[model samples]
Target: MSLFQLQFIHRHRIVRLDDVPPQRTLLEVLREDLQACDAKEGCNEGDCGACTVVIGEPRDDGIHYKAINGCIRMAHSVHGMAIWTAQDLTQADGTPHPVQAALRDHHATQCGFCTPGFAMSLFALYQNKVCPQQAITPETAQHYLSGNLCRCTGYRPLVDAACSLNDSPVVTPDDVTLRTQLSKIEPRGLSNDNPYLQPHTLAQLLHLRRIYPQAQLIAGGTDVGLWVTKQHKQWLRIIDVTQVRELQNIDTQTTHVRIGAAVTLEQAWATLACERPELKRFWHRFAGLPVRNSGTLGGNIANGSPIGDSMPLLIALHADVVLAREEAGQVVERTMPLEHLYTGYRQNCLLQGEVLAYIDVPRPSANEWLRVYKISKRQEDDISAVCLAIQLKRDAQGVVLDASIGVGGVAATPVRAHQTQACLQGFAWDEARVKVAQQQLQQEFTPVSDMRASASYRSQVLVNLLQRAWYESQDMRCITLETLA
Candidate 1:
């Protein structure tokens, strides 16, 4: 098959590139090639959202606009989509957009380095607002603006601007034109006989994996982007799976929710939160909006980071991961418990040429009670010092029928607290049983000390977290450190 030209709509015109490097990020292309410097490169990684841009694609309803970090997104991934930067929001006559005007009216700019990214993020939210809606609250604005950070401490005015957007007339995109333009550019399979290969289907992906077994598989490039920015290590070849339609599916089964490997964290959490509303708070803390918008659930699990918040929660829920590989001109699929998938620190059971296909999470039963807790230095957009997830079932007498406890950042990999779970099973749901389980949890793993917390502190926190879970399981109000003081 011949290599197809990378085509995308930028600033209302089609831009085509044939010789773009595979490793080139969208941020580099915007600043260096297109001279669209409004999307500033703050950290050169996805952490700082100064490189935020809104990408619109044709959906069933209309154009779906999403705010993503341009620093980690590959230049080729935007093919067949409409790319919008902060500069694109201005009218042809040079009038400021509604979001830009609102920010200016609310005095949301200081130093002005982060304003463009913030405006673009707000632009996406503004464009996608549902009809017959109430006014956007400050809390809602804060949630949407969480990804874009400003060093000048200018959040109050920015949040005010976000809330006041609804007061003005809603500006709708040219959906008919955008959808028509996007449909013209078919989803191209990109391969330049180079290391970067983006296959449009699962068959092509597995075939390419067989051809390039050593190529690094990247979904959203959230963690891989850090390697290039911080470690300065260049990957010889990269297979981007984000383009594979089969791996981007979210299927609702009668007994389980099957989430594709390439499904972004934002989409997976939205579906998961519907059945398990307890995870709503935990989902928000998974990362800032931009990271969640770009990062994939499968990428997070396959990275096998000990502190990865998703694994522990999934482990507690008894999720299974599906692994796939092409063999004898057919696809071979294998499903295993998510806990057993991880072997050690940043390690997994995936064999060479095999790829994670989907994560099958069982729907919560009516009797099941689930809770997840994350202890971090910062409340938003920070790695967990220690994360805990507990799933419990009780009988009519309040006797523990079953228990699953998963812990992270205190073990080589996210691990199930087998001893603690065993200790809690068949015990009465009372303070005495929780105390014994807490003791078992402390002795289950010898956590290493690091910058986040000391080994002793992690051990103690495990015990306290168990107690807190017990308090929460009952009707009693739990006292946290902040409230105690």
Candidate 2:
């Protein structure tokens, strides 16, 4: 039984590219399948910049766009979106767009393998030309391009190339008629009319779960797609949750913000940016624009990576995970704290038949201050050596009302330092209080040593991050990289 056919929808229209296999990666499709060879495959696992491409997706709030590593993205993943490669940046008259023109004028290209990836990454920035809601400063420019590695041209010229695209016209169909030409490509075919469950409603999703109990449930394929592309493994039976409409909504009522499991990080961040501007900074550094565009809050939560950055913040915010399962032909939903959602390393409490449906974060009061900090070897596009998120509330008299601290990269799962939180409660937050809290963090966990950082370094960074949180809560200005030199 065929539940539905998989189609690669691009720019509000389906792209029908002939001779491409269903499980092929977007990088391979751009390079080999579609013959658009600019997006190279430097590191097949999404580390290098050679395979960068900007995908244009129509989001509910706005046009959600980001530069994703084409090397790891599956062809079917580009459905219902418009993809722009570096090859699309020039005008019909053969004039280069500002981003390309700037790169050329600045002599940004060296080996040129990384150039196309950088061009596409910058092109994504160029398309969204207006000043971002969170200003794209030099720090952010570095963060955005961190996932793309260039061995030559030192990165200054590339960064300059990005900054110069600020005045360029938007890269949309209106500007270049790019969509009309892109629509000419043919669609890739899925394996043998095999049933692909696309549940649009909560009731339907559950019903299908029972119907296909053995079907593999998929959300964002940041992790699972590797099973196909990198691992060369295929799921004979799989049900993608991306098409489930109910699971993709982000609802904010008077008391809480409910983010559906299928909601992309791009969507969730925008929703949270209004309420928590501080979170915008972490969201920018969460992943490159592309990974953020497709990766989801639910998927990240369900992934159960101990070093994952999002879980620590969600844990600190007292967020809840909602799980949906099929029971005797009916859909049942259950809710629990985000921390309890995991069991151990590479393991989660989720049932075999259940899918994470949504996450709910209680709205913070006006006096409550929340901050999240990720300490990694690199500023962006890297896993955390120690991920810390803190939520603090104080009364008018400067007495601590309540406090919650969550730390990752220190244990089997993202965990809250309840004991540390207890030590800070009711204590006057002076230098003395900071010292005690910092010392308590050292006692919180014995972080495992890894290549990104040593256990001692991770421990120290956690303490430093908490102290920084203390200052940030006070709106105190501190020295940053820009101020150092």
Q: In TM-score terms, which candidate is top?
A: 1
State TM-scores per candidate: 0.95, 0.85
lDDT by residue for model 2 (284-377), tens: 7788766776678888888889999889988888999999988877778899999998888968887767878999998878987888877777
**RMSD to the hidden true structure, all candidates:** 2.1, 4.0
Please report how far candidate 2 places residue 18 from its true position, in Å.
7.4
The most accurate candidate by lDDT is 1
Q: lDDT by residue for model 1 over 120-141, one digit each (tens)?
A: 8898778866233556887678
